[model samples]
Target: MTAPAASPALRRPDGSALRVLVVDDEQMLTDLLSMALRMEGWEVRTADSGFDALTVTRDFDPDALVLDIMMPDLDGMAVLQRLR
Candidate 1:
Protein backbone atom coordinates (compact mmCIF):
# COMPACT_ATOMS: atom_id res chain seq x y z
CA MET A 1 0.00 0.00 0.00
CA THR A 2 1.17 3.48 -0.82
CA ALA A 3 1.82 5.95 1.96
CA PRO A 4 -0.29 9.05 2.23
CA ALA A 5 1.10 12.13 0.61
CA ALA A 6 2.40 14.79 2.95
CA SER A 7 1.18 18.36 2.91
CA PRO A 8 3.66 20.92 1.62
CA ALA A 9 5.25 22.77 4.51
CA LEU A 10 7.06 26.04 4.81
CA ARG A 11 10.65 25.41 5.77
CA ARG A 12 13.60 27.54 6.60
CA PRO A 13 16.67 27.68 4.37
CA ASP A 14 18.24 25.06 6.62
CA GLY A 15 15.27 22.74 5.99
CA SER A 16 13.84 23.26 9.46
CA ALA A 17 10.21 23.98 10.26
CA LEU A 18 9.43 27.67 10.15
CA ARG A 19 9.12 29.25 13.57
CA VAL A 20 6.32 31.70 14.34
CA LEU A 21 5.54 33.89 17.37
CA VAL A 22 1.98 34.90 18.16
CA VAL A 23 1.60 37.77 20.63
CA ASP A 24 -1.67 38.97 22.03
CA ASP A 25 -3.21 39.88 25.37
CA GLU A 26 -6.18 37.70 24.49
CA GLN A 27 -5.46 34.09 25.24
CA MET A 28 -8.16 32.86 22.89
CA LEU A 29 -6.76 34.85 19.99
CA THR A 30 -3.27 33.56 20.56
CA ASP A 31 -4.60 30.01 20.84
CA LEU A 32 -6.37 30.26 17.49
CA LEU A 33 -3.33 31.79 15.82
CA SER A 34 -1.04 29.15 17.21
CA MET A 35 -3.38 26.40 16.05
CA ALA A 36 -3.39 27.69 12.48
CA LEU A 37 0.37 27.98 12.32
CA ARG A 38 0.85 24.56 13.88
CA MET A 39 -1.41 23.00 11.27
CA GLU A 40 0.87 24.51 8.64
CA GLY A 41 3.77 22.54 10.19
CA TRP A 42 5.32 25.56 11.79
CA GLU A 43 6.84 25.90 15.23
CA VAL A 44 4.38 28.10 17.10
CA ARG A 45 4.92 30.00 20.34
CA THR A 46 2.54 32.28 22.19
CA ALA A 47 3.18 35.38 24.30
CA ASP A 48 0.41 36.98 26.32
CA SER A 49 2.02 40.38 26.64
CA GLY A 50 4.39 42.63 24.72
CA PHE A 51 7.11 42.11 27.30
CA ASP A 52 6.77 38.38 26.96
CA ALA A 53 6.79 38.75 23.24
CA LEU A 54 10.12 40.55 23.36
CA THR A 55 11.65 37.83 25.44
CA VAL A 56 10.33 35.10 23.17
CA THR A 57 11.45 36.96 20.09
CA ARG A 58 15.00 37.05 21.33
CA ASP A 59 14.97 33.37 22.20
CA PHE A 60 12.86 32.02 19.33
CA ASP A 61 13.98 34.41 16.61
CA PRO A 62 10.89 33.42 14.69
CA ASP A 63 10.65 33.75 10.94
CA ALA A 64 7.40 35.68 11.43
CA LEU A 65 5.63 37.50 14.25
CA VAL A 66 1.87 37.86 14.63
CA LEU A 67 1.39 40.71 17.09
CA ASP A 68 -1.72 42.40 18.41
CA ILE A 69 -1.90 46.18 18.47
CA MET A 70 -3.90 46.44 21.67
CA MET A 71 -1.83 44.76 24.35
CA PRO A 72 -1.85 46.19 27.88
CA ASP A 73 1.81 46.13 28.83
CA LEU A 74 3.06 47.39 25.52
CA ASP A 75 1.48 48.04 22.16
CA GLY A 76 2.46 46.50 18.83
CA MET A 77 4.16 49.68 17.65
CA ALA A 78 6.31 49.82 20.75
CA VAL A 79 7.29 46.21 20.35
CA LEU A 80 8.31 46.77 16.75
CA GLN A 81 10.29 49.81 17.72
CA ARG A 82 12.12 47.94 20.42
CA LEU A 83 12.79 45.02 18.15
CA ARG A 84 14.31 47.27 15.58
Candidate 2:
Protein backbone atom coordinates (compact mmCIF):
# COMPACT_ATOMS: atom_id res chain seq x y z
CA MET A 1 0.00 0.00 0.00
CA THR A 2 1.13 3.54 -0.72
CA ALA A 3 2.21 5.62 2.17
CA PRO A 4 0.34 8.72 3.26
CA ALA A 5 0.65 11.73 1.05
CA ALA A 6 2.84 14.63 2.08
CA SER A 7 1.32 17.21 4.37
CA PRO A 8 0.93 20.88 3.62
CA ALA A 9 3.96 22.85 2.47
CA LEU A 10 4.20 24.80 5.70
CA ARG A 11 3.71 23.71 9.29
CA ARG A 12 3.44 26.22 12.09
CA PRO A 13 2.58 24.12 15.09
CA ASP A 14 3.70 26.42 17.87
CA GLY A 15 1.69 29.36 16.54
CA SER A 16 4.81 31.44 16.89
CA ALA A 17 5.31 34.44 14.68
CA LEU A 18 7.94 33.99 11.94
CA ARG A 19 9.32 37.01 10.19
CA VAL A 20 11.01 36.20 6.87
CA LEU A 21 12.90 38.34 4.43
CA VAL A 22 13.44 37.10 0.87
CA VAL A 23 15.93 38.93 -1.32
CA ASP A 24 16.37 38.16 -5.00
CA ASP A 25 16.95 40.07 -8.19
CA GLU A 26 14.45 38.01 -10.15
CA GLN A 27 11.04 39.46 -9.58
CA MET A 28 9.18 36.27 -10.48
CA LEU A 29 11.25 34.12 -8.15
CA THR A 30 10.91 36.63 -5.35
CA ASP A 31 7.16 36.73 -5.74
CA LEU A 32 6.87 32.97 -5.75
CA LEU A 33 9.04 32.62 -2.65
CA SER A 34 7.10 35.29 -0.84
CA MET A 35 3.77 33.66 -1.70
CA ALA A 36 4.89 30.27 -0.47
CA LEU A 37 6.28 31.64 2.78
CA ARG A 38 3.12 33.63 3.45
CA MET A 39 1.01 30.51 2.95
CA GLU A 40 2.80 29.02 5.96
CA GLY A 41 1.16 31.75 8.08
CA TRP A 42 4.44 33.62 8.28
CA GLU A 43 5.07 37.32 7.94
CA VAL A 44 6.97 37.67 4.65
CA ARG A 45 8.86 40.51 3.07
CA THR A 46 10.66 40.66 -0.29
CA ALA A 47 13.46 42.79 -1.63
CA ASP A 48 14.40 42.82 -5.30
CA SER A 49 17.70 44.61 -4.95
CA GLY A 50 20.63 44.75 -2.60
CA PHE A 51 19.86 48.27 -1.48
CA ASP A 52 16.27 47.35 -1.00
CA ALA A 53 17.28 44.32 1.02
CA LEU A 54 19.29 46.52 3.33
CA THR A 55 16.40 48.86 3.75
CA VAL A 56 13.99 46.03 4.42
CA THR A 57 16.33 44.46 6.96
CA ARG A 58 16.36 47.71 8.85
CA ASP A 59 12.61 48.09 8.91
CA PHE A 60 11.34 44.50 8.71
CA ASP A 61 13.90 43.13 11.19
CA PRO A 62 13.18 39.63 10.04
CA ASP A 63 14.12 36.63 12.11
CA ALA A 64 15.42 34.88 9.02
CA LEU A 65 16.73 36.12 5.70
CA VAL A 66 16.82 34.24 2.38
CA LEU A 67 19.11 36.01 -0.04
CA ASP A 68 20.48 35.17 -3.47
CA ILE A 69 24.25 34.86 -3.72
CA MET A 70 24.56 37.03 -6.79
CA MET A 71 22.56 40.24 -6.94
CA PRO A 72 22.88 43.62 -8.58
CA ASP A 73 24.49 46.46 -6.61
CA LEU A 74 24.82 44.23 -3.53
CA ASP A 75 25.43 40.51 -3.41
CA GLY A 76 24.52 38.23 -0.55
CA MET A 77 28.07 38.05 0.72
CA ALA A 78 28.38 41.80 0.69
CA VAL A 79 25.11 42.18 2.51
CA LEU A 80 26.15 39.67 5.12
CA GLN A 81 29.40 41.49 5.53
CA ARG A 82 27.69 44.80 5.99
CA LEU A 83 25.30 43.31 8.47
CA ARG A 84 28.19 41.99 10.48
Candidate 3:
Protein backbone atom coordinates (compact mmCIF):
# COMPACT_ATOMS: atom_id res chain seq x y z
CA MET A 1 0.00 0.00 0.00
CA THR A 2 1.13 3.53 -0.65
CA ALA A 3 1.80 5.96 2.20
CA PRO A 4 -1.09 8.13 3.35
CA ALA A 5 -1.35 11.56 1.80
CA ALA A 6 -0.59 14.52 4.03
CA SER A 7 -3.49 16.71 5.06
CA PRO A 8 -3.72 20.35 4.11
CA ALA A 9 -2.38 22.80 6.65
CA LEU A 10 -4.82 25.18 8.37
CA ARG A 11 -4.40 28.84 7.49
CA ARG A 12 -6.00 32.17 8.25
CA PRO A 13 -7.59 34.55 5.75
CA ASP A 14 -4.28 36.38 5.28
CA GLY A 15 -2.53 32.97 4.81
CA SER A 16 -0.79 32.79 8.17
CA ALA A 17 -1.03 29.61 10.23
CA LEU A 18 -4.26 29.33 12.21
CA ARG A 19 -3.70 30.34 15.80
CA VAL A 20 -5.36 28.25 18.53
CA LEU A 21 -5.34 28.74 22.28
CA VAL A 22 -6.05 25.77 24.58
CA VAL A 23 -6.94 26.40 28.22
CA ASP A 24 -7.17 23.69 30.87
CA ASP A 25 -6.30 23.30 34.51
CA GLU A 26 -4.88 19.91 33.65
CA GLN A 27 -1.42 20.26 32.21
CA MET A 28 -1.56 16.87 30.53
CA LEU A 29 -4.71 17.75 28.68
CA THR A 30 -3.28 21.05 27.52
CA ASP A 31 -0.07 19.40 26.32
CA LEU A 32 -1.95 16.67 24.49
CA LEU A 33 -4.20 19.16 22.71
CA SER A 34 -1.27 21.37 21.87
CA MET A 35 0.60 18.43 20.36
CA ALA A 36 -2.36 17.36 18.27
CA LEU A 37 -3.04 20.87 16.98
CA ARG A 38 0.62 21.47 16.20
CA MET A 39 0.72 18.26 14.19
CA GLU A 40 -2.08 19.73 12.09
CA GLY A 41 0.11 22.81 11.39
CA TRP A 42 -1.70 25.17 13.70
CA GLU A 43 0.03 27.64 15.95
CA VAL A 44 -0.96 26.43 19.42
CA ARG A 45 -0.63 28.00 22.86
CA THR A 46 -1.75 26.59 26.20
CA ALA A 47 -2.77 28.16 29.52
CA ASP A 48 -3.17 26.21 32.76
CA SER A 49 -5.57 28.63 34.43
CA GLY A 50 -8.31 31.06 33.56
CA PHE A 51 -6.22 34.01 34.69
CA ASP A 52 -3.32 33.02 32.50
CA ALA A 53 -5.72 32.33 29.66
CA LEU A 54 -6.85 35.92 29.67
CA THR A 55 -3.28 37.17 29.61
CA VAL A 56 -2.33 34.93 26.73
CA THR A 57 -5.55 35.70 24.89
CA ARG A 58 -4.71 39.37 24.84
CA ASP A 59 -1.20 38.85 23.51
CA PHE A 60 -1.84 35.87 21.20
CA ASP A 61 -5.09 37.09 19.66
CA PRO A 62 -5.84 33.52 18.75
CA ASP A 63 -8.35 32.72 16.02
CA ALA A 64 -9.83 29.84 18.02
CA LEU A 65 -10.06 28.64 21.61
CA VAL A 66 -10.46 25.30 23.44
CA LEU A 67 -11.45 26.00 27.03
CA ASP A 68 -12.22 23.75 29.97
CA ILE A 69 -15.31 24.50 32.09
CA MET A 70 -14.04 24.01 35.65
CA MET A 71 -10.92 25.80 36.81
CA PRO A 72 -9.42 26.86 40.12
CA ASP A 73 -9.09 30.59 39.66
CA LEU A 74 -11.73 31.85 37.22
CA ASP A 75 -13.49 29.03 35.35
CA GLY A 76 -14.20 28.94 31.62
CA MET A 77 -17.52 30.78 31.70
CA ALA A 78 -16.00 33.80 33.37
CA VAL A 79 -13.09 33.78 30.97
CA LEU A 80 -15.34 33.64 27.92
CA GLN A 81 -17.54 36.35 29.35
CA ARG A 82 -14.54 38.55 30.01
CA LEU A 83 -13.27 37.90 26.51
CA ARG A 84 -16.49 39.14 24.99
lDDT of each: 0.92, 0.86, 0.95
Clashes of each: 0, 0, 0
TM-score of 1: 0.88
Index of the highest-TM-score prediction:
3
Model 3 regions more than 4 Å off: 1-8
Evaluation by lDDT, superior candidate among 2 and 3? 3
lDDT of 3 by residue, 1-84 (tens): 999998777699999999999999999999999999998889999999999999999999999999999999999999999999
lDDT (C-alpha) at residue 75 in model 3 = 95
Clashing pairs in 2: none
Of 1 and 3, which scores higher on lDDT?
3
Clashes of 2: 0
Query: Quick one: RMSD of model 3?
Result: 2.2
How should the candidates be ordered by lDDT, best one leading?
3, 1, 2
| TM-score ranking from best candidate downward | 3, 1, 2
Q: Identify the candidate with maximal lDDT.
A: 3
| True lDDT of residue 36, candidate 1 | 85
TM-score of each: 0.88, 0.79, 0.89
